[model samples]
Target: MLSLRPGSSGSLAPESSGAVIHPSAKCLIKRSIDILGALVGLVLLGLVAGPIAIAIRLDSPGPIFYAQTRYGLKGKPFTIWKFRSMVQNADLLKQTVSNQAQGLIFKNENDPRITRVGRVLRKTSLDEFPQFWNVLRGDMSLVGTRPPTEDEVSHYSSHHWRRLDVKPGITGQWQISGRSAIRDFEEIVHLDLHYQDIWSPWYDLQVIVKTITILLDRRGAY
Candidate 1:
């Protein structure tokens, strides 16, 4: 479980307390880029959302969108939106499935909870398109760390909280660095920290470009 003891500042400190690590967190230029990128993404989403919605409706019986709470910067909770890619009762049935990945995060590439349409959505990452709204709303960035669920963060070590210093992203080190293949949560934390250490507008741009290539090829996604 996480060390929730408050620091002198009355806020929980990361396992290894350190100064703020990401310049992107406070950069007005980075914020501007996020806004622009999110707008473009929303436009693209607008174009495809209809067909995707129809497909989901035909493929399963559930709402068109799925809204869930996710932890963001400093472990703040916010609603993250996605296209519904699972059965309506998937969350309720979570315990019925086994977690293939180790540590705080959970993953199961072959999880039976995923619908047939969900599989394609996960592979193509179309399921993530709705999160552009989160970026536009400032709950997320165009590039940063992956947003963690409450269950995952509940068990975080003090060091694990470091990844939450910046806003969560629709695409980041985890998405580009083998989403499902990299199952170990510690590796993900390493990638998240590495992203913060090396982040610059140029670096974010590179990651975004590489992400596009990966998405186009449908590589390393589900």
Candidate 2:
């Protein structure tokens, strides 16, 4: 078994201490895919996201972008970026509304804190566009498991950590399968493990196709 210790930066390091999984062929290929997608996504961002940013600014009094720490591959923490979709101090008000989700997840389908522009952004998944930058930075995949927040990760058992063995994604089985329709976090883990276990370029393609279809139909979006 490979043992790990905290590095000077406070992130986990393997016992080998020298070779990270940065040079493997699979890793390189995955990075290439991410880079290509991010480049193309940047074009779309230029065309669409600028107006969305303006609309968000006009509708709310907060930063246009929101970054939250999320657990990535092997439980490493990285900041996940999204368009600000809630009130300026939404985090401070999270406890004001009870979580409607099951397990460690939090959800409020009718969260009063959501702004008008924010509602449109979430419904269209436009709020997710900034994550292409995350893909560019090698912090996320185009398709994988949902990135869990630090608090969510804190509640994870050993079995629940399996989803973190691979990079977190912009969209995954969780999004295409049901998204807000999914109430149980265990079911999300189940779908995520299934994707991780059966992952392939073809599987990624299928999920992307499904995601595009769902987005066009605006199905199961909160």
Candidate 3:
């Protein structure tokens, strides 16, 4: 089991208690799984990506991609790619619209910036399909902590920053647990740390299976 300590500011504390190294066998196995799973997903999705791209282009007047700066492993910065799901300049327009979710994160179920095709893509989580490429490129894993935006990264306390110690992931404990339903940033950090402490190839496989169910049910996604 993992330990959780309270930070000086009362938020969660970073796992500064020294590194808990995973077995080399576990690390190699997990990486192999990530590579193989991502490859298969990319091949399968490739067949459908063209039609989706066309749909997005027809429904919106913006570039086909949405790239945002996100924090990756060890708190490094990387750009995360997604099929553009919002209108051009959506980032600039975020402040002008009313935010629907609680805490530091922003989520608006009826965000005006979303295009018609974007709504479909978001509902099916097709927007995230592009991230498989990130996994292949080694910027992300098939499962781990969801990468935070650069702005969100800035607000993290040292404890919250523990999520950055590992690679940013396409999906993780948070996504399988509740995703947008889990509103507290502190709770999110706690879950991410839990993952870091107990990570295994089997755990990743379990999360992937659960994610498929969650996607099909579409619970707590938005």
- Find the candidate with the highest TM-score and give its number: 1
Model 1 clash count equals 2
What candidate 2 gets wrong by more than 4 Å, as runs, is: 1-9, 12-25
What stretches of model 3 exceed 4 Å from their correct place?
1-26
**Residue by residue across 97-131, what tens digits does model 3's lDDT show?**
89765555777778899889888888888898888
- Residue 43, model 2, lDDT: 86
Pairs in clash, predicted candidate 1: 15-158, 15-159
Over 52-115, each residue of candidate 2 has an lDDT whose tens digit, in order, gives 8899889988898998988777667788999998999999999898788889899889999999
Quote each prediction's TM-score. 0.92, 0.89, 0.86
What is the per-residue lDDT of model 1 for residues 37-140, given as tens digits with 9 covering 90 to 100?
99999999999999999999999998999999887777667889999999999999999999999888778888898999999999999999999999999989
Score candidate 2 by TM-score against the native. 0.89
By TM-score: ranked, best first: 1, 2, 3
Cα-based RMSD of candidate 3: 5.9
Clashes of each: 2, 0, 1
